[model samples]
Target: MTVVYKLNVFKDPEQLNQNVFAAQYAVRGPLAVRAEELRAQLKEKPDSLPFTEIINANIGNPHQMGQIPLTFIRQVLALCQYPALIENAEITQKLFPSDAIARAKELLEETGGIGAYSSSQGVPLVRRDVARFIEERDGFPSDPNHIFLTTGATQAVRMMINLLIARPYHGILLPIPQYPLYTASMALYGGRTVPYYLNEETNWSVSVEELQRAYDAGTAEGTEIRAVVFINPGNPTGSCLNEKAIEDILGFAKRNGVIVIADEVYQANVYDLPFVSFKKVLSRLQTENPNDAWDKVSLISIHSVSKGQLGECGQRGGYMEVTNIPEAAFKQIYKLASIDVCPPVAGQFIVDILVRPPKLGDPSHDLYHKQIKDVHEQLFKQCRQLHSALSSMKYVKCQEPRGAMYLHPRIFFPKKLIETAKAQGAEPDELYCMELLESTGICILPGSGFGQKENEFHIRTTFLAQGEEYLKHYVAGHNKIMEKYE
Candidate 1:
């Protein structure tokens, strides 16, 4: 029996002009969705099944992998969700470290309760706290009015792109081995992505010559480059930036009339060495370009509490600050942001607590520092351990994950394995990774999922395997499978 489907919707006027998101396809990767189905089936199977382990490194949800959340952020969240907790002494103490308590009490006094909605832009106090955090980090005074709180940094990123993309020819400059969020968002928003290559030989750091080459070619191709997105302490590639590279990029932005989009979400995850913030780098560079104020070049930075010590991936708390953006440009941005109503109130409360917390000797201070210190050291240590282990393996080349949790190891694809994978009709990287998954029950993302050099095969796995047990599972599973292919 033949089942036929009609394709007549395209003839309708509403359908012809309607759906832009349908054309965007990368989000629906077979490996990701199929993993979900496989998991459901595996869940019902017994432990004595053929699969040796199930280590999920496919997504970057640290908490899902058994990471503990910071007490301060979640405490306030509980209080926000259920106001009765405000009267509970133990609950109130945990909810706020110290300054948060006073601020929350003040807000309650002024508003009577948090049950009502906040201003369309965001809570003024929370935005002010975000501004203060940025100011102290960069040593430059930031205006609270310019801060726009969002559910997560992703929303802020899309909103900013909407303002920049006025016409079809509009383009954004992104790094080659870039975060999919940027490219995916650009596709959905009807903008072009001009990719610049990072120096893979130099541990995936950006080089001035490379940026110059990309910018020149993009402009020559008649694509109006409105912004350059820099993921400091880069995602997936896990490379930290040096001061010189930061300055070079800033200078390029100033010269090119391109806005700088700094995705500093992993700012606090530096392992062996410290990660520098774009705000700090730009503050110093602005001194060099002394004459230019906001017009020299505009900079917008996106940060998330979902990362760093807060690691509250589910809470979705973050802020985006516009630095040196003109009043007119900001007007357009504010108008669009206002339409979102406001970021989640509970998430806003968490961000407020994160950006501004209690000092030492404050009631919650000891607990806050105690829990945070342990979590930071443990996570950072894990990053170092996995990188060291993977680096020592044969045919696997990996740089130390100085910032983010991901470890991307370049694989040595054997000819036989490549031929087999090709015959299997799967992307070479996908074929290699899937075999590893089924053989070991360990799921990981292929480098091709994120952008990597062509003909290159790599895999990215998180260090967040549920402590030592799964860590041992990861090492044994990967080593065993990879040895067979070799």
Candidate 2:
């Protein structure tokens, strides 16, 4: 007897949500996938590729690039994971610092255990600690009730986009060279993307006029513009927004009646300009003009332990603080979070430690400070080295690294390269990145993935990998490609 075969439930791509297919996350896009295949080949044969090892400059992942985890964070996490370790005070004392033990005990009390789920909103104590962290950072009071611990800022962004983009015509203004998360989320949520190009001449400065122009263009196309996203200490561009810039954006949001979604996950990664929280700037504006529309502006500020010195990306620890959000919308946000149960309990513990770390005179203080300082210095040094290398390259103009882990260098491709890429139906930068990867085993993202001006080319690469040795190889590969294309 012959058996009948049935088609899979979502066999046709059209049968599924088209939005899912529309979403493109270039950070882990095609290039990153191919790099993995190369990595596996290298693991088996050790010399299948031209280079020995893959340099993952594609994403801002510090730990993956050999940055050490904070000893204090790991110690506390160890105790939290196995509370029984804390029971044996004698042995625990020898292995763990007094502060780590105490902190772990406190967190365990709040979370019950890393295995058990906390409140959908998050552990109350952890939320409170996050509130305190914000309060201290912004010099303004924060309400724990308004805080929601998320898997990472990524979740918060998705939630906000889902909530705000209720209609197909709804749109969110995004930086042209944005972190792909915003663009991907927008696409997945069925929202229009209003592109506002960052001013590369002035270190990727946010222009109010550009914002208005994008907003007007989106509006003219029948889009209900609901929110604007800002990535402070920018992702690929490495541009830190000043206080005035934040204020101007808030004012724009207020005038246009759109929400402000501030992604400040790299708040601690600043090297040149001082990082300013949107919450802080908004708070001051409200205070200065109590009767103005400032108080009416709704803002969601997000932070994460994934970036900065911690580099705890895998932990999935982050929090979003909502201000001036309507009570009804707030409840809905909570409802959505509850549907997902709770974020990783272990991640919550990391958030707690991030906001409230070892203070002065604590046993873990000196070591924690030392580790942080070393990471900061190393990151700054790497940024400088890469910027210098790019500056000397022909037809490449790179902005100085201000903050963030990655540098996005503008590459003026040769006319021949452009014509060849067009003939093959590809972006010039995409071809450039692929060539660089094949020759050097160095994986980086093409600017097309992050959105760029027409007729322009760029590559976004993180300087997270240690040592200047890889720099020589990267430069050689880049020069080879540039010469070949020329």
Candidate 3:
């Protein structure tokens, strides 16, 4: 034939946007892919690998690791999905709790039905509940109009990153050993990242001086620092920020005239430290210094039902509350949300349940509280067990997890292992993690995926993996790797 066909759009990787190509999410990066491959292999050929199972410690997915969903939440969700259950008095009385039935009815009435699209911003009643939740948590007033229900905190973060980044040079400050979503968003949106290192020696505490230094350096290099992100009860490190620390950060944002994006999804995941909201601190500052421009500092605080005791990651329910944002900017944010039409309607319903759970004296109250307490206690126990195991390992310095579902332990690799990693064109920690996965079928992430100080090595593992048996396997595998290198 004489005719030739024209190339299709986006025919190759090079034809696509380079920024998307550059973005990396280490939690599900190469190691995770390999883990999946191994899992498939195990399924097809049972005795092919040395280990029988793959313990996924790479991400904070609780239900995947056997954390049971709260009965009350599931019951309410079921009723919302099928209102006929509520209509059937016999079925409702036997199967669903009174509070769950009532909550579902209220949400169904407010939302019309789960099958229909909600307001682009969110369901009105759900937003109000979220506002009330914030007020109860932070001891400050919250506006329902200012709240936007999202698919998860991830969507809220993406929206804010998109808004803050107008041009290529616009910068956002992120913590090193970050959750990787921050850096990935910056890469996708063509935003510059100004990394401020947390003081690892001090249990991953944020430093005002470090913030100032990074700001000055980024500004000197012609990077316009647009916003600062604070992951309270941080993702990888699991360190909670004190109220004073949060206040200092807000003051910093005020001075720089930049926005504050508080990623407080892990707020309820705190273990040792009391969780304090940036909204709380900022509101207090504004009240105390009425003459100051505290009210002018734009802040977006995010929360999700994914991480806390609910462990509803599959539901993808979350909300972000905007404060001190100008009306024009708020409109723009609303426009962006409108373009997406709406978040999952079912997810929106979960947000409602999360904010307004079974109250005291309700039939579901005792069971709900007990389930939450059990989950909390189990997580705490796992955190202690994992931390202690890693701490005992040679050249491993594990921080006691204060909050969140992860433990980011610094590993001092043997010199020989570092050389081997360099030979393989990999970071030492990455090589260690790879070997660990191959040996024990336990998949974890390396510190290099999250930015780290030069010459420092670390690994991020979630304590969410079930049982103590895997911990023993992890320790043995890690020690064998060290001894091999030595």
RMSD of each: 3.9, 1.1, 1.1
Model 3 whole-model lDDT (C-alpha atoms): 0.92
- In model 1, where do residues sit more than 4 Å from their true spots? 1-28, 88-104, 107-115, 292-295, 483-486
Give the residue spans of candidate 2 off by over 4 A: 1-5
lDDT of 2: 0.92
lDDT scores of the candidates, listed in order: 0.75, 0.92, 0.92
> What does candidate 3's lDDT look like per residue over 1-486, in tens digits?
699889886677788899999999998899999999999999999899989999999988999999999998888889988898888999789987788888889889988998999999999999998999989988889999999999899999999999899999999999997989999999999999999999899999999899999999999999999999989999899999998898898889999888999999988898988999999999999999999999988899999989899888988889999999888999999999999899898888888878888889999998989998999999999998899889989999987789999999999999999999999999999999999999999999999999999999999999997678988998899999999999
Error of 1 at 269 (Å): 0.9
Between candidates 1 and 3, which one is better according to TM-score? 3
TM-score of each: 0.90, 0.98, 0.98
List the candidate numbers ranked by lDDT, top first: 2, 3, 1
Shift of residue 108 alpha carbon in model 2, Å: 0.9
Q: Which ten residues in a row have the lowest lDDT in candidate 1?
A: 18-27
The residue pairs found clashing in candidate 2 are: none
Model 3 worst lDDT run, 10 consecutive residues: 7-16
Candidate 1 structure quality by residue, lDDT tens digits, 1-486: 999988787667675533254333332466667666667767877464456446677766778777887775565555555666667768667646555455566555544456666775678888888888888877877889878888788888889888888776889999977777888778777888888987667788898788878888988998888999999778878888877778778878887888999998888777766766667777776666677653467888888878777777777778888888778988888888778877777677777877887677667687888887887888777777777767766667886577776777888777777777889887677887777667667778777767777778778777776555555556676677667777
User: Residue 468 deviation, candidate 1, in Å?
Assistant: 3.2
Candidate 2, residue 258: the lDDT equals 90
